[model samples]
Target chain A: MIADLLTTVLVLAGLAFFAAGTLGLLRFPDVYTRLHALTKADNLGLGLVVLGLMLQAEGPAMIFKLALIWVLVLAAGATAAHMVAQRTWTHGEFERRE
Target chain B: MNLLLVAAAGFLLLTILFGLIRVLRGPGSGDRMLTAQLFGTSGVGILLLLGFALDQPALVDVALVFALLAVVAAVAFVRQHGLPEPAGTPMHENPVEEQPHDPPHNPPEDTHDR
Candidate 1:
């Protein structure tokens, strides 16, 4: 019962962050700021969701697997954001906005 | 518990729907690419939530694969869209490379010498 309650709260929080990230994507003025939104919020959001799922997961193996997926996502999100931002900066796309 | 998980997943789907608008209307490729990243991450979150909600653990593996693929996508984007830094704005200040008095880095020394 406690596990169910915890999962509910974590999942909802994760969803809220996802919503905020999407909102930032729509409302931010530039690509860099949007990257900020997507990377930061989505990373945390996914982390929380994964944690919530872990609570309900059966066996240590399943918990480990969930954690692994979240870590992979966190790394990928940071890497993708950096590479995309670097490309944009190098190409002067942001400058074009100004 | 199932209801909560499903509701959370549904909410994430809504965010993805909203993010699609940015992807469609973005003024720049960077914007689109990052928005796609948002999709990838959020998709993983939704999948994991649904996996638990539906009592299927294999979906977690699917999410792992998705995350790996997203990294590869970013790598490909970087490679395809890489731009040469402006002549004056060298990333490093090597004396051989950043000689302000010398000719710019373009045109090989041999080509210029000839």
Candidate 2:
């Protein structure tokens, strides 16, 4: 029962972050800030979800697999965020800001 | 527990759908591409949740693929479009600094007519 409760909390928290990230993406003023939303909030969202799922995961292999997915996402999300931010910077998207 | 997982999956899908707004109404290509990247990550989350909820471990592999391939798309976009001008030195400020062949010039009269 405790395991299920923990899982539910983690999952809900993760989903909330995802929702916040999406909302930020919609409402943010520019590409750079939007990148902030995607990188930070969404990444955390995925991490928590993975953790929640890991609790109920059956085998060692399944747990490892779930963890691997989170790690892969962390690496990929950070790299992509950097690249996009760099592109936006170089393109002078927000250069005019004082 | 299963129902909670299912609900989580549904919420994630809803977020992905919300992200589509940026993709659809892009003021810039970078924004569109970034939004797509967001989709990729959220999609992975949804897949994992669904996998556990439905008792199918195979879906994890699909999530892995989504995570891996997401980077490829962004890299391709950066390669093709190229980076924007570097910060700190506005191009207008130094027209002849790099391009000697072309002289420092102002916009055409018609362009400034507005």
Candidate 3:
């Protein structure tokens, strides 16, 4: 029962952050700010959801696999964010907003 | 029993949809790349959630492979063009900027007529 309750709460929390991230992507004024939102929140929100699922899933291998996936996602997502931000700036895509 | 996982799965799928919006309207290529990153992550979560809910072990490896692909995409972006340094971050707050210009170490060359 406790595991189920915990999973429920965590899932909701993860979803909240995920929503907040997308909202920021839409509402933020600039590319930098939008990257900030999407990179951090999306990575972290997905991490949390994976963790919650790990808590519920049986088998040590399964949990380990999910954990590995999260780590990979985090590394790749952050790197991609950096690259995109770099490319955008280099390409003069961001017009300085007042 | 399965309802919670299914609900979580739904939320993750919704997250994917939001990610699509970011990609579609991104102001630049960088934004598009990063938005693609989010989709990569969301996809892994979906696979895992489905695997767990269905008690299937096969999906875990698929998620792992997805993880590998995502990393490759990120590295490719970086290789083609290095990531942008964050604003206000001085890569090297050159103390040299504060120091006076140094004179040439070697003697000045003489212009002698041959």
lDDT (10s digit) by residue, model 3, range B1-114: 578777777887887786787678765666677667777777787887788889887988998899878867766776655444443336335454335465443112211121
The C-alpha stretches of model 2 lying farther than 4 A from their native spots are: A95-98, B84-114
Which tens-of-lDDT digit does each residue in B19-113 have in candidate 2? 88888888888888888888898889989989988988899999988977889989889866765333443443654444556444533321222
Candidate 1 per-residue lDDT over residues B51-89, each given as its tens digit: 888988888888889977878877777776654433444
Scored by DockQ, the top model is 1
Superior candidate under DockQ, 2 versus 3? 2
- Looking at candidate 1 chain A, the ten consecutive residues that score lowest on lDDT are A89-98
What clash count goes with each model? 0, 3, 0
Off by over 4 Å in 1: A95-98, B85-114
> Model 3: how far is B57 from its true place, Å?
1.8
Per-residue lDDT, model 1, residue A72, is 85
Q: How big is the positional error of residue B102 in model 1, measured in Å on the Cα after superposition? A: 27
Give the DockQ (2 decimals) of all models. 0.68, 0.54, 0.47
Please give the ranking of all candidate structures by DockQ, highest first, separated by commas. Answer: 1, 2, 3
Error (Å) of candidate 2 at residue B75 is 0.6
TM-score-sorted candidate list, best first: 1, 2, 3
